[model samples]
Target: MSLRTALIVLTVVSVTADTMILPFYPQFFAQAFDVHSQAHVGYYLAACCISVMLAFPVWAKIARRVHELPLWVITQTLAGLLGIACYFSQSLWQFWLLSQLMLCLKASYLMIYPYVLRLEERDKHLGMVGLFAVLMQLGGILGAVVGGALLEHYSARSLYLWMAASDGLQVLVCGYLMWRLRQGWQAPQSEQSTPTRGWTPHVIRLGLLAMVFYCAAFFIRPFFTPYWQSLNPDSALAAVSISGWLFSLPGWVALLGLWVNQKRPGSDDHAQVLLLAMLYGCVGLWLQASADSALLTIGRIIYAWALFQITVRLELWLFAHSEPQFYGQDFSKLHLMQNVGVILASMTVGHWVSAWGYASTFVVASVGLLLCALCLLWWRQSDSRNAQPSHS
Candidate 1:
């Protein structure tokens, strides 16, 4: 199989194994650790956010030096082992440590995207990126639905065991794919390409903008479940299940979007796509602030749409712009910024919810999204001007 196909398949496995237990994390931590307050859950989640935020950049830089294939092989193996350990974790501390290990493995998955990009024979970068996004979203959908049902009937620990099995499958797939690449790997054809260089002011500015974009988009995610529970504590499990299904719609929507792109090629104008997605996201958040159930459902759908579009574009753009050798580090920095958003969002969102209520919290998130959109618009215009025909 081609490297592109292999990467899409691995993305499915990676997302499935990683997201399988996410729906239950807030409740799981609260119940397992005997924590009562949402604020406490926020703090514990911030621990994860911080650890992953710190760890991915280090891992990315290391992968840039050591190569992604070896990193993938080692991390997946360790992750499967950690998954098993997580199943038997008796204390919250044990669970937390095990979770840290898993995040390391999970974060490494992004490296696979760049490796596949480096390996592809064609220049269909944007199309392949869309495919990767579709697979990831679909995998999350499947994992959440299956996982929620399993959580309904089985112990939460059992979910970890199942996830371990999934990771084991991932390791096998990754190993086989890497071996195949090595059999035919040729650097000569792509090597003539000059690497994009510099820690110059411009490069730094672009990287920082990418970081800010992710941070604003993802900061409040950890609190979504807790917020749902606050609305309906008695039906927390049911609410979670429903929310999982709700979230899955975005994946299906993304798959449809990709399919349409395949049928009728369109502009890969990353800037315009991202700007529109962000605008829609603001609308979604405003709708979410409404007390009406119908309005909330509408908001969820809108939120999913915007998120699916923005992430797909961002991932593709990052790979297209980055030098192959530094793909891992660049993507890792992107992931770190995303986590920073989560950490800050967790701390601030809860307090905002308490002070101004959920409606106000949504408003704040919407405003942040708008501000990010405006910044990206300016960046996009600047980039366009910089793209003027260079003297050949």
Candidate 2:
């Protein structure tokens, strides 16, 4: 296979492995260890996020020192092994710790983004980035569907085994890519200064906006399966299947967003697009907070569309603004900020849900998105004013 094809395939398999357990997380914890607390689920998810946040920067540093393909092969293999170990976890705590281990090892897959981008012309970055996002969403869709079915028909342990299998496939692919590139591959040169760059005002604002956006979006994630069960108590299998479909439906909309981005390949109105998306997302969150199941389904679809567009635009903005050589480190910093937001949501939403219920959590999440929209609007206005010359 060509290098591009290999990268794309690796992206699909790596994301599939990473997200395979998402739909069944709550169910797995409840079934395996009889741990039913939403707060506990939040804490576990937070732990996973924290592990990835810490591990990403480390992986970026290691990427600078190691050749990309070999490093990816090692990490993918180790992640697969750790995932298998997680399958045998006997307790909730054991599973949580093993999960963290898997995530830490798996974090190296993130380097693929910058690696692939470096291989292409700068103008192609947005299209390539959108393609990467679309492939990731496709992988997520497949993972959610397969994971839900496995959890419902088979055992929770099967999901871990499947995840491990996916990682193993990635290892083989990366190993092949490493061998194929051996002749022409050069290690990335060491930077004269530290990789970390000073945060510009625009970057700082974007980071804060991303933080709020993620926090709002993920507040309900850890408890989504349980919430679905609460709504449709008739059959566990049906609930799992429906939840998987609901999660996967967004990918279709994301594919549409990718098509649109292809037609208009620029960041002329990214701020406006982002603000509009947040508004739509907030409306979706409110609809979800309602008691009607139909409305909830519609809400999920709406939220997914907005999420797909927002993420694609945000990544384009990052690539457009940052230096090419620093893409890996810069993207890692953005990922870290986003995960910190998720961690904040995971830590607080659990208590909020435990107290006031899921609807209240949704309401708070909508409010958070509104605040993000306002921040973006203000930042844009300030930017426009700064761009204009003095009248004198």
- Give the candidate number with the greatest lDDT: 2
Overall local distance difference test of candidate 2: 0.79
Which parts of model 2 are misplaced by more than 4 Å? 90-94, 183-186, 190-196, 223-240, 264-267, 390-392
lDDT of 1 by residue, 1-392 (tens): 76666667778777876777766675666556665677767786678778777777666555534556666778878888898898888887788888787876667777777667776643677677778778877887777777778888887678888888877887788688668767332333343243534353434544555555555555545456555556666764447656655546678778777887688765667778888988998998888777655687788789877877777777666766666765665666666666666777766766766777656766777887788788888887887788876633
The candidate that wins on TM-score is 2
Write down the TM-score of every candidate: 0.82, 0.89
Sliding window of 10 residues with minimal summed lDDT for model 2: 183-192
> In model 1, which runs have C-alpha deviations exceeding 4 angstroms?
65-67, 178-216, 219-243, 294-296, 380-392
Residue 330, candidate 1: alpha-carbon lDDT = 63
What tens digits encode model 2's per-residue C-alpha lDDT throughout 245-272? 6656678887987898789865657788
